[model samples]
Target chain A: MRSSFVSFTLNGEEKELLIAPGQRLVDVLREQCGAMGTRNGCGQGGCGACTVHVDAVPMLSCLVLAELAEGCDILTIEGAARDRTLHALQEAFVAEAATQCGFCTAGMIMAAKALLDRDPAPQREAVVEALSGNVCRCTGYEPIIAAVLAAAAMLARLPAAAA
Target chain B: MTRLRGRGISAVNYPTGMNLGGDPSQALIHATTTGNFVVTLSSVDLGQGLRTIMTQIAAEVLGVPPESVIIDTADTDTGPHCMGTFASRATHRIGNAIIMAATEARNALLDVAGEELEVAAADLETDGDGRIAVKGVPGKSISVLDAALAAHFKYGRTISGRGIYLKPRSYPDFETGAMDPDSCQAHACTIAEVEVDTETGEVRVLKLTSAYEIGRALNPMMVEQQIVGGSWMGMSHALYETTEPYYPDRAHGPVDFAEYLMPGPADIPQYDAVILERPSASGPFGAKGIGEMTANSPIPAIANAIFDACGVRIDELPITPEKLLRALDAAAVAPRR
Candidate 1:
């Protein structure tokens, strides 16, 4: 078995970890680096439960090879907050009760983050389209959509990086 | 016009506990030295907000704020027995147990508070703010924290309670085939409006308006969550989901979650639910079990809606477009009245 070392900036912290051939980024982040927030609902790319931000774009980490993330900046749910303060999206999720079972919350939040980072004020349809890839079985996606739109409005009113 | 519109309604009554009714759930509650009530139970939460609702129930019974109660129902190691989380019985069954247990603990607390305030236990009423006071005596009150501390140090007593709710098995008379099936019933009525594409045989549900009577809304938000999420599941069951779509030829069955064909956010319709809290006599503070019953009415409602649109009754689960088109074709080629 061929194993190689890969380096990436994860949640602002630089990390160099050993990876095996065919090891998925999700597995490395979970099994090797102990990032448990990135859940793997399905090993295949069908479910967006393993979504992560690679260079600020949401990518299904289950399909991406761990070695492919070398030299790239990655962010998981653990990094969504700063200074022990929750991000606006996270806060909005809590306020709206957007999660049930909480299995898809990390991916759902990441996908919503990707949409909000670019389009601060997205329509309900846009929010719906943005979260189409993430599968949440318990919430019916109503509150999640509300949380995203609320987070968008919250972001629009705040200074950059204050959340 | 390729698109045809239709409407349908369905009403159903769902039971709270198991049929025949012999299941039991238990709970134990004790106050910590800090006056926070800890409810010990083996009941599972499973994202249905069981812990939250149980905490609220305990707080209500103990006459304390919800924040002052902790639900320790993680596992069986340190908790009492429970009949598992099924048949929508946790809230109704385990909740009754908590009320019993908390009532006992409340009595014990009042006894201790009575001793401290030099009044009878019946004369002390807990004022929702964690303070036990004599009736009509505002200044003669003791904080729950001080009372709890005194219970441990000076009084040498414990404020605790144990509860269990057991429904006896109902024997049906062989003559009439009658028996008490469940503890209580929850009712629902859903009206589904849909559009059917006649040419392509595609069906789209536009809205689902429903009314539910679930005894009580202990936590209305969680109840609404169940109704919305369950309706989505019902819609999926009506037109999309099936493990045996080919019927005994399992080759084309869904192999993964993506192939399982649940309705995504894009497929969600305008879901509105109206809840009626008609309190039940056997429930915990009139709260019934309403976990997944909200999914029941929508299935038949959608089927009936499809029939109204095209005048074709497709009697099948996962009423796929092929089934609808075939039914339409069969109806068309057959002799009309």
Candidate 2:
């Protein structure tokens, strides 16, 4: 097995890690970076419980090779909160009671964040399309969809500075 | 040339709690030195908010705010015995036990406060905000924190309680086959509408409207979540999911999510649900369990909808396109003579 050193900006922090050829990004994020929030539901790219943002795009970390993600800007659910306050999306999720069991919460929030960041005023169908990859066995995706839309509306109302 | 639309409805009822050897659940409650209540149980919260629901029930019984109540679940070695989380028994069984335990702890708390206030224990009342006072005088009150401290150190009393809920076993009359196995029952009614393509025999669910008589909803949001997830599972089982493609052939089956079929976002239909609250006499706070029963009605409802859309009575698990097409062919030749 070949192992090499890889560097990437994770959660806005520039860090380097020792990675092997087969080590996935989910493994490094959970084992090395200590980001337990990024849950590993399925090792395959299926469940979407290991979703993370690479260059502000939601990608299944389980499918991404750790070495190939070098030099990329990675964002995780641990970074969703800023300055001890939850992100708008996280607040909406709690307010709407969108999370149950909390296993898929981080990935679901990260996916919603990418959608809201790209399109602040997404329609209901667009929100549904955005969350197609993620799987939430609880809450039936209705509250999650409502929470994402609520977060979008909240962001729309916020001042540019706060946003 | 055009798709045919049809609607169907189904109603189902399920018993709450498995009565195997008189299924029992136990709870332990104690007052912390910081004037808080802790509920310990072995019942696991498998994402259905069992902890939150149990905490709410304990707080209600203990006469304290919900924030002051903490619930610790799924520790079997230290916690009391629970019959596990299946059979939709977590809320009903565990809740009854917590009420018993919290009531005892509340009595202990009042005893200590009564001594501090120089009032009879019967004359004391709790304000649900961690305070105990004389029945008519709110001004002369002592914080629960002080009462707990005095009880522990000065009075040498540990405020704790233990409880268990057991349904009495009833032997079935073997000749008549009459027996009451469950303490309570929950009901669900689902109406499903679907569109079927005649050419491809593909069926797509358009909308689902359901009414659930869930005894009482301890947390309405969580109940609704369970219903929605259960409905999706029902739809998946009816139309999309199948591991055994060819029956009796064990060699071929879907191994992963890619091959296995479950409903995704694109397959979800517009869902409308109405929760009917009918308090159960035996359940805690009139709330019955709604976990497994949520998926019961939608399977038959979907099958009925397919039949209503096209007059093809395909008595099978999944109304597959191939089966539907074959049924349509047989119906066309016979044409309901």
Candidate 3:
């Protein structure tokens, strides 16, 4: 295979890495970028455990080729926190006991993050629809929905500056 | 024709540990110079929060806050031998061992503190705030940290303990067919409601209401997660999951998540769970092993509901549409298209 060079902003940090031709973005992010928090659950697009924010959009890194990420801004689970405090979604997940096994948590949080960013006050069905791609084999998705709603309320309660 | 609705219930008794040559688990506890307790175990967590629960058990026994106790399930080299994690026996077996070990560690801590305070070991009790105080005399107390320091440097004694729990293998009385094979048994019942389409042979589960009599829910939240997830697995096994649709052909096995069948978000049914706790005789703080049984009852419950809906029984896993249509035709319940 051919070698390719790519540069992207990851978690607000500028990153430049070498990649092989046709390599998956997920593989490059995990292997080269050392973004181990972005788990590779299925390696295919079916399982959304490798979800990452590309240009502020939730995209399945497993399906996207590494070359496609050139000059793109990527955000991973590691970026979900500010300073030492956890993101509101992370706090809600812990409070609601939504991250049981934690395998699907990063991707689940990323998906929820995207939804919360798009619609800060999502309804219950809307939260379910947003998280449809993310599969949590634990908690039966009940606590997950509750966590998203709880996060939404928390965001709503926060002042304009902190949010 | 409109869809037919039916409800069915299933009850099952599940045993705790697999008593294979006396199932056993061991735990070790030691205190650092700063009085932070460390618990070592070879049994893995597998994301089930075993370390967290074990830490809570140890802290309770040692009379320290959970944050002051750390659980180390990391290398087997430093941990004690275990029978591995299976049969839902980690909490029940390993927990009991930790209780014993922590009790001993607590004794050692109290003894060291008693020596430092010039009081009897039995007269001192942990105050749950990093201090050991004499019974009924809260003013005269010594910080566990200082006692631990004294034990290491002054007394030259290691404040540590080891523990193990075993439910020995029992043989049946062949004449009467009586045997005590398990330490304890937990019970579960699930009620499933489903809707079946006569035209398309499609079955959709509407809701699952379940009740569990797990000896004790050490963490109710964790128990709820296990129950709901296990029931989903049961539903998947009852209707969707199949590794070999065309068995013996071997050409069409699933290669990845795309080919494999599982219930996705849209496919989930409403899950309701109720937990009842009856402390066990030999459990660690009245907690029993209840990880696997939550998946078992839902399978039979779903199968029975489908039968009640269309007067057909599909014992085979998946209860695929093809088999359902065939069974419906044989029963003359198939609506004429």
The DockQ of each candidate is: 0.74, 0.64, 0.68
Candidates in order, TM-scores: namely 0.95, 0.96, 0.96
lDDT of 2 by residue, A33-135 (tens): 9999999987887788999999999999999999998899999998889988889999999998888889889989998999988899999999999898888
Residue-level lDDT for B83 in candidate 2: 86
Clash counts for the predictions, in order = 0, 0, 0
Per-residue lDDT over B221-328 for candidate 2, one digit per residue giving the tens place of the 0 to 100 score: 888888887887788778877765655566666677655667777777777888999899999999898999777788899899998999888778777788889999
Give the winner by lDDT. 1
The residue pairs that clash in candidate 2, if any, are none
Q: Write the per-residue lDDT of candidate 1 for residues B1-337, one digit (tens) a residue.
A: 4899999999998999985547888999999999999999999888889898888889988999999998897788767989889888999999999999999999989888888888999999888888998899988999999889889899899999999999878889899998887999999999999999988888899999889999999988888889988888889889888665664667767877777878899988789989999999998888778887877789999999998998999878888888888888898899457
**Prediction 2 TM-score vs. true:** 0.96
Error of 2 at A41 (Å): 2.1
Q: Which lDDT tens digits does candidate 3 get at residues B94-167?
A: 99999999989999999999999999999998878788999999999999899999999999998998999998
lDDT of 1 by residue, A1-163 (tens): 7999999999999999988999999989999889999999887888899999999999999999999999999999999998898999999999888998999999999999999888889999999999999998888788899899999999889987584
Q: Pull out the clashing pairs in model 3.
A: none
Q: Which candidate is the best by DockQ?
A: 1
Per-chain TM-score (chain B), model 1: 0.95
Which ten residues in a row are the worst by lDDT in model 1 chain A? A154-163
Give the local distance difference test score of model 1: 0.90
